[model samples]
Target chain A: MAIKDLPRDEYLLKGHAACPGCPITVALRIALKALGNKTILVIPACCSSVIQALYPKSGFNVPILNIAFEAAAAGASGVSAALKKLDKTDITPVVWAGDGGSYDIGIQALSGALERGTNFIYICYNNQMYSNTGIQRSGATPYGAWTTTTWTGKKEHQKELGEIVRAHHIPYVATATISYPEDLYAKVLKAKNMKGPRYIEIFAPCPPGWRFDMSKTIEMARLAVETGAWILYEEIDGQFAFTSYSKKILEGRDRKPIEEWLQLQGRFRHLTEDDMKKINSHLDEKWNQYKKS
Target chain B: MKTAISLPTLGAMGKTGTWRVFRPIIDVEKCIKCWRCWIFCPDGVISRDDYPTIDLEYCKGCGICAHECPVDAIKMEREKK
Candidate 1:
């Protein structure tokens, strides 16, 4: 497909209260632009709920349902079901939720929707904390990161949300980041056209929450992917194939040390050499498991 | 003579954005003493005395110091442009 197919009229507009470098807003904008105007959003009580705002001033150009904290997937499923009842055929329902909403509170509803093979796009913008609730540590938070609940640094437990979603045998499951907007847009667009449930976990950077600079939002995302803190790959109905694996990163010829990425954001500043070794081993284990599967 | 610092190879943007040299210019007039920046800095590259000084050796072009300036004191403008 040509690049023009990505479209230009962004559904998520420029003015919103999101911090200067909130990558969730960027991912939403890119995803909506790719998904086009024939889309409806179900947002839970997370950063996007506030970012979308009240009745008339939503950042979204399309229809948006301000769902409850734990009902984004269910709300989207309900919307899809109601549309079918009304004989509607063309619109795409998108369930957008934060890390806390998806990885913890909304997992049951999400799993139910996926199990029933609901035709909807589930996009989880994982900034790894309950950011809107004052940056408390959540199930998605990485090891050695400092949050309000983990001021001494998070105690080495990060949920494998991607693998858990992949277990549902959705039509599509992918890990993407705002650092790769084109890839992110392309995946969301592909998910839009697919017939069954689609799940995309986007690693969005939260500047205020992560204690990062507004300008370095994209930098952090890039680092997250490069350092293997975040993995980028795609699975089509459980058929795993990594699309963005470059010669350098895969072959290790031109790979910059992962530390280059981590040293940029202060969230990982607490990571000592010992801690980093453990993280490396953890990521390697996850990667090898995916390969074996 | 100092060895040159290389560009980040993480390439999460898939080789999209180019590394244009950026230099931070801090306006002393608008300088806020809160230093939310110095506290959150990962690299210890920004040296704060009266105003913050960016030591390029450890500065990875993340622009955290420039972006975290609560006041309009620090500006991260393109060096060549």
Candidate 2:
């Protein structure tokens, strides 16, 4: 469906506390449009909590339960159970969190909820660092990227949270990015209709954390996919298939050099040629796996 | 005991227009009205009719609309201090 075909309802209201050109807000706007009014958000301690603004003045039209940093999935599970008890199956319990909340602190709770077959949507809008807490490196922070804690660069590669969740063999799991709104919307809408645990990780490029021009957020995200730095795919039950531009990349559409993506972000300015080689080899290995899959 | 809860309201943190260094000006004559600007806007400030109308009161001058526009229909002009 086309962009105009999407619902015109505005669940994410205007003039929130989000910074100018925040990718999280952009992704949320599209996801909320798909989710519609019968949705309750379970937000943890992330920029989204701040983006929702202070008490007595919310930026979102939907009800949101702001929980602790590590309790997003657990809180969502409780909300899902309560909704089930009330026979309010129409309402969706969505956990909107960041990398710090998902790949790091909340993984245990998330694993528990998924294992229990909790009916909820867990979305990790991974900006690759603890952006809300001043750009510290997190488990999802990519190798050779600078953060407050990683002054030189992060020594380890990012945690494969999607693969970890996929191990649960949940009903729905997808990787999306802010650049492709339609793909993101479609995935969220599909996950909304299905039962059991759903996980979608959106590659959100932070303007401040990634150190790019605020307006270039979409460009940065697009470059990520174009460079094979990020792959977009969906796994339903046991089946898997690449989607959108990533589908093209899998079918021999040449990937642009990762440097095209890296040079744009200030966080990667310190990455040496040796580091670049490591990053390229890692990407090759990932694409090789994708090809084999 | 006090509780923290927010009611849905526009401009939750006061006017964001002042935060803008640049303001987007749509060239109505050149407009294609594709709705890219309307969808990509983080604040949900742009409304679509035949053409798009931006709500400058809450628009943070992100320039995303200008950057994402397929055509050069939108321009980012410096906001007057």
lDDT of 2 at A132: 93
Candidate 1 per-residue lDDT over residues A121-207, each given as its tens digit = 899999999999899999999888889899988986789788899899888998898766667878987898898799999988888
Deviation of model 2 at A106, angstroms: 0.3
Q: Using Cα atoms with residue i matched to residue i, what is each candidate's TM-score against the true structure?
A: 0.76, 0.98
Q: Which stretches of candidate 1 lie over 4 Å from their true place?
A: A1-5, A246-248, A251-255, A291-293, B1-81
Model 1 lDDT tens row, B1-81? 964322212222222123326656778788766554443333333455676666543343446567656676877777664
Q: Which number leads on TM-score? A: 2
lDDT score, residue A180, model 1? 67
